[model samples]
Target: MAANSRFSIAVHVLTMLAKNCDGRVKSDFIAESVNTNPVVIRRLLCSLQEANLVVSQVGASGGTCLARQPKKITLSEIYNAVSHGEIFSPHPKTPNQDCPVGKNIEAILCRLQKEIDKTVEQKLAQYTLQNVIEMVEREKV
Candidate 1:
């Protein structure tokens, strides 16, 4: 299955906004940077806006900007804003309760998935958008 890109895109959006030297950046510009459609960036922008991670403006000079400082925006907050559902999807149909392996598999995987999700959340909380920007600064040529 294709991995969901919402989280990564959300971070990219925020990072761009943090470095938004011009104050606000347009979706079209952000989309160009991400090499995806503007609508995709706009859609993700909605979620980030809802989470208060970013703000938008309208009209001739309209665009988007970060709602909080880079240091205050945690990766966990970004992940929570864009993420929905479990890390690992469950079976489409109910597992064969009649079969020993099928009966126990989904539940087993779900337990592990929860553990992983929690761990990921905790780790993400330890970092912030400022951390990403600093790394980017160091990597710049």
Candidate 2:
């Protein structure tokens, strides 16, 4: 399966907002930075807003901004906001029941998948948006 970029995009959006703490940013500008369309950015923004990770305003001079300080927003929160499905999905079709490995592989993989998901969430929780911004700034030097 193709890897999804929503998580990274959301992080990028939050990082930009954190860097520009003085003001809100428009979706067009964020799309330019992300190399994606403004519509995609807006959709992601909606998910972030629903999760309380961002606050958006509408009007001629309106845009989006972080709902809270960067240090208070964890990567896990962003991940949860944009990721609607599992990181790894099982095969589309069921495995052959007659085959021993195929019969049990799904169950085994599912158990392992759950562990992987938990670990991913835990790791993401350890890094806040501020941590990402620091990494970005350090890389610029």
Candidate 3:
């Protein structure tokens, strides 16, 4: 399956907003920085806004800004806002029942996937948007 970039893009957008919290940022500028189309950026922004992570305005001077302070937003919130699929998807077809491994593989994988998901959620919760902004600043040497 193709890897999804929604989570990454959402985090990037949030980090940019946190790093430059002076005023609203145009989606065009954000698109240029992300190397993607403005429409894509706008779509992601809409999702963020729905999640209460961002707020947007209209008109010539209108743009987007974070709804809350960077320190108040967690990576877990962004992940849940944009992520659409299982971290580990099951096989498309059912495994053969004759083989013991095949018969039990799905159950094993399902349990493992649940454990991984829990761990990832815990890790993501430990990170805030402020942490990401600080990391980005450190890389600017």
Candidate 4:
């Protein structure tokens, strides 16, 4: 399965906003940084807003900012906000079930995927938005 770009983009946008927390960060600016279209940024903002990760304001000097302190948010939170499907997905067009392995492989894959998801979630839970921001800062960006 293809990984969603939204998760990475959201993290980048949110990290930028956290670094420049004195004011709101414009979606346009975020789009520029991500090298994507502004519309993409807006769409992403909608999901982040829904997840309570960012708050948007409208006016001459309006933009977006993290809803809570950077330390309060988590990478998993951002991931969940934009990642609509499972971290991994089986083939939509089911594999042929004539063969024993083919029939049982789907079930085995499902179980293994669940285990992987749990491990990933546990690791993600340990890293907050602040941790990400700090890393960005340390990287001199």
- TM-score preference between candidates 3 and 4, better one: 3
Candidate 1 lDDT for residue 23: 78
| Candidate 3, superposed: residue stretches over 4 Å from native | 96-108
Q: TM-scores of all models?
A: 0.86, 0.86, 0.84, 0.83
Q: What tens digits encode model 2's per-residue C-alpha lDDT throughout 1-141?
A: 387888988999999888877888999999999998999999999999999999999998899999999999999899999996376889899999999999999999999988888889999999999999999989999
Better structure of 1 and 4 per TM-score? 1
* Candidate 4 wrongly placed segments (more than 4 Å): 1-3, 84-88, 95-99
Which 10 successive residues of model 4 have the least lDDT summed? 82-91
How well is each residue in 54-109 modelled by candidate 3, as lDDT tens digits? Answer: 99998999999999999999998999888853687899999999999999999999
Higher-ranked by lDDT: 1 or 2 = 2
C-alpha local distance difference test of each model: 0.91, 0.92, 0.90, 0.86
* Whole-model lDDT, model 3: 0.90
Task: Show the colliding residue pairs in model 4.
Answer: none
The prediction achieving the highest TM-score against the true structure is: 2
Question: What does the lDDT read for residue 28 in candidate 2?
Answer: 95
In the range 9-68, model 4's lDDT, one tens digit per residue, is 888889888987989888888889999898999899999999999999989899998899
Instruction: Say what the RMSD of model 4 is.
Output: 2.7
Candidate 4 C-alpha error for residue 4, in Å: 3.2
